[model samples]
Target: MANPTRRLEESESEGFVISGKDIGLRMKALEYWKCAELGLQSNPNCAVQSFKVVIAEALPNQGPNQIDTFLSEHGGPGIQHIGLHTSSMSGTIKKLKLHGVEFAEPPATYYSEVGRLHDILGVGQDVQELKELGILIDTEEEGECSKSPRYLLQKFTKPLFDRDTFFLEIIQRIGATGFGSGNITALWRSVQAYMNEKHHPEKS
Candidate 1:
């Protein structure tokens, strides 16, 4: 499914693709991710400035599959996460935090390093603002340009279910349409830390 709709006066769209491949189709599995990147770029945005959500799931108890891991914990193949885009990630995060939504926050060191790249990367928001709001920034290279048009910000909500299967992504795109590939590792670590802190503080 792919269609743009209004989200609180902001343009939004959601695209979904499900494959029933069994384990061992490693190459095929990656196609889903690649397809998602294409989906985000191709989603129409005529009515308003657009945002996108990509939803994916696992087939069954596939080995080492994150989607399957979600299914295992959640009792079925279900929503792994929901990505919501915003123009003002700082303000949006602030409001959500005030409303008691927990998010995975990167450490000060992450922001410190990111700040050093601001000039070269042409980031749109202040490092301090992003750090305070627990937002992560990512930059994509466009053709021969030294830096991309705009950076992306993202934060993941604490899992809504006790089993840690589902969560929300608060996202903002300054100019880029693709997801933040650069932020994946840091975001994963942040999520792992958050999960450990919440589910097993002793392990943290």
Candidate 2:
């Protein structure tokens, strides 16, 4: 989306160039989650390959927000979260909770909606456990309504750092390859809402 108006000559610019302030650059949130994942496999067709690594970045929101405060406290851009993979989200959440790990609570009505419940059960996940554990679920190709549904289950832990800067995401992908927008927005909003309630940071 960035079209540079001019390029700096070899002698005119440093290694980095901060772009000009112009239109069409509006962003709402103060920070966003970025994740990179790698799979290690002995050979192709390996049913389940080991996940070598998953890098997560929490960049400060471009506009005026509390994430800017977090970044300032963090000494610049840094990893604020990590997504851990799990095969059974319900079981994992149950065990983690029993051991005293607190997960972020999604909207209370997240499971109350009938359509959302349908999607969760359609993907062959247990709706009762998901609702009880405050887990978020999302899938694609809703219109097609294939007998087999590809969906993802995700839940976030409360901020691990002293500040509301770092947290962990527990994710389970059932035939889903990419992150779901619904889940991402839900996660971001939940964090923002929590921060606003706890810190009451000034907004520009």
Candidate 3:
């Protein structure tokens, strides 16, 4: 990845891609990520706890060739992560691991944080299991003094292709809908570190 990726709303696909400013491929390629997300979460009535698609593109001025491995292979300028919803996150993860899929490690202190730890236990999730799976849990609180809050569970697989350009995110949403700011910084830093190490090794 030549530049740090910027979040592009789904609405920008048509106009942004047509401008041909750094973004590679075209309308169809832009549509492919959305299509791919839908394809991954195909079962509508699987009684899934939660799932949503988040799309993004590269920020300009970093370098000339903007297209990354994911864009050239599975997705387009839509680099970053793809969140797939599954009813059974732990089960799915175990199965994926059995097949040799590796996931990104969360910050070591994630589960030790008081608020986050409370959220995990409040939701009745297994602390050890979550820690072992490297899942990050977040809550979309309801106002300051609201009674109930919704939860979001997520984990990102390391980039399957070379150089950390893209990855798959396994997300389970239980009445919550925020990209999860709780752990976003950690996630962002990991991606940036990978980009620097792989593309600008000297700076890294």
Candidate 4:
């Protein structure tokens, strides 16, 4: 489902607080897809709405792995990757790999730490299964607003097409509404390592 967590009918002002300082953030207008309108009369009393959140961030200097480089190489900025949700990550990964799909393998050091994390919060799936499938796991601690902790597992398909622009992600979230922030950095570094080994850019 193409869901948007936030919607803006008009331009709005927003910023972030970094190191106790307010920093202005850049906002971009992304192209939107048209959907068939629901022909039901809107109810003002019922206060509930659903949407999706598109996360954005600034890229490091003009490196081979930078977003600007990607945009310059590809025609323009588009869907960098698509994340697919699944209930059984291990099964999905096995099936996809059997069909000749290659995935980026996170470093062994990353898994070494997973064992420690598993002790405090239960592992979502079998640790060995995740290792064999090269799946990454992330968890969110329960807070005042949330009653129970959550878990997430994800694996990314290697870049498709010659330009290495678009790719796919297989994800499974348990009691989690937000994407795993920890997974983002871990997976990104792993993907770059994979790219370096396969593509081997002289400078990045």
Candidate 5:
């Protein structure tokens, strides 16, 4: 097990990376986001309910050393995961898992304590449903008074070259109309934890 970031850096140093093209794609994505905003503002009934994006290290089947070569040729820093919206996250997760979809394991506490938090935040979702799917919920503030319910569901597996790439996130929005800004930090923390475990299995 090796640190994924460290591995990426090492690969770069070894002249096997994709840097420039990745940057170009990111810039393009930013432009797309801007345009999407404008389009949404212009048309209220536009098809903007949900969208999915995947950002991951390039897959091996894409080419021999394509990921490394691409990263080496370009200053690689891009998306490596996708988010899919689902009417029923539980059903979706179960089906995806059955179909060989991999997921990252969030801390058990994320599942156990989220229900109490959801109740406090007044979110209208079934906590048990989330738990059954091994989803994790997070909020920005801690303690009794804070009541904003934003959550992150993560799962991990060795795919696309013995490296953790794609992950599935199931989001059920009640009042929020966009990605949960408050829960990002928590998601990052969970990712870091997964990476650490992947890099140091002995410790686990």
Candidate 6:
């Protein structure tokens, strides 16, 4: 007739780590024991994934005008751009550029390294095609001699202008999904730098 609660408290004081599965099992056991004491049935499926709660932000709250006004006064929104997915990013970028679209300057070395990593990872992308169409690419893979995956990420962005908003983005992916998280950071930094240059022109 020892106190189970006291034993658990002692175990925690001794730095005992419990796995998630073990905690779930213990909770189920406790529920079963309580049900038995009350002459009731214990449902084992109560711990299933179907009971998880998922929350999503509403779209109206994130409308263009609302976001723009918020950022204009608060020094650019942390999210400087949105990515648009396409099958041929290179071709899309080229066509857009020809139609007077503007883009941030992507580091040439970054593009080169991404291409090399993509080749090593068997991603089978067209480097020359990308070059001819002026698309920028970046990947998480290190390189051929590195111990990491060759290339598991890619990124692209295009700016759009309308009466309602300053810019939007056009992105493409072959083996990836969603916006490249760090890529957005880098793009935002670049935009800030450009704004700084524009406000305070360099002395010749």
Residue 113 of model 6 has an lDDT of 49
Model 3, span 1-204: residue lDDT tens: 112223332244353222232333222222233345455565544334343334444335433332443465455555556778876888888899899987777767767865667788887889999999888887766656556668888878878776456688887777675555455544644554565566788884
Q: Give me the displacement of residue 30 in model 4, in angstroms.
A: 10
User: Candidate 2 local accuracy as lDDT?
Assistant: 0.61
Ranking by TM-score: 4, 1, 2, 3, 5, 6
So what's the TM-score on candidate 5? 0.51
Tens digits of per-residue lDDT for model 5, 110-196: 544434454534555566676666664433333365455544433333233344543445664433443343333335446556666
Model 1, position 31: C-alpha lDDT score? 22
Collision count of model 6: 2
Q: Give the TM-score of candidate 4.
A: 0.66
**By the lDDT metric, which is better: model 4 or model 6?**
4
Models 1 onward score TM values of 0.63, 0.62, 0.58, 0.66, 0.51, 0.44
Q: Sort the candidates on lDDT, descending order.
A: 2, 3, 4, 1, 5, 6
Task: Count clashing residue pairs per candidate.
Answer: 0, 2, 0, 6, 25, 2
Off by over 4 Å in 5: 1-45, 48-75, 112-116, 119-121, 138-168
What lDDT does each candidate get? Answer: 0.59, 0.61, 0.61, 0.60, 0.44, 0.40
Model 6 misplacement above 4 A: 1-80, 112-122, 128-134, 138-166
Question: Candidate 1 on 88-170: residue-level lDDT in tens?
Answer: 88889889989999887775566656333563246546756666777787765554654456667889887787788788888
As for candidate 2, its clashing pairs are 30-61, 31-61
What is candidate 6's lDDT per residue for 54-159, written digit by digit as tens?
Answer: 1111123323332344266446544434445456666677777788766655444434543343553355657666555544454444445555433323333333
TM value for model 6: 0.44
lDDT of 2 by residue, 1-204 (tens): 222222222122232122222211112222222221334433433434334332233333344333454577578777667778898888899999999997778766667654687787777777887778889997766435455677888999988877667889898887665444455545655776676666775641
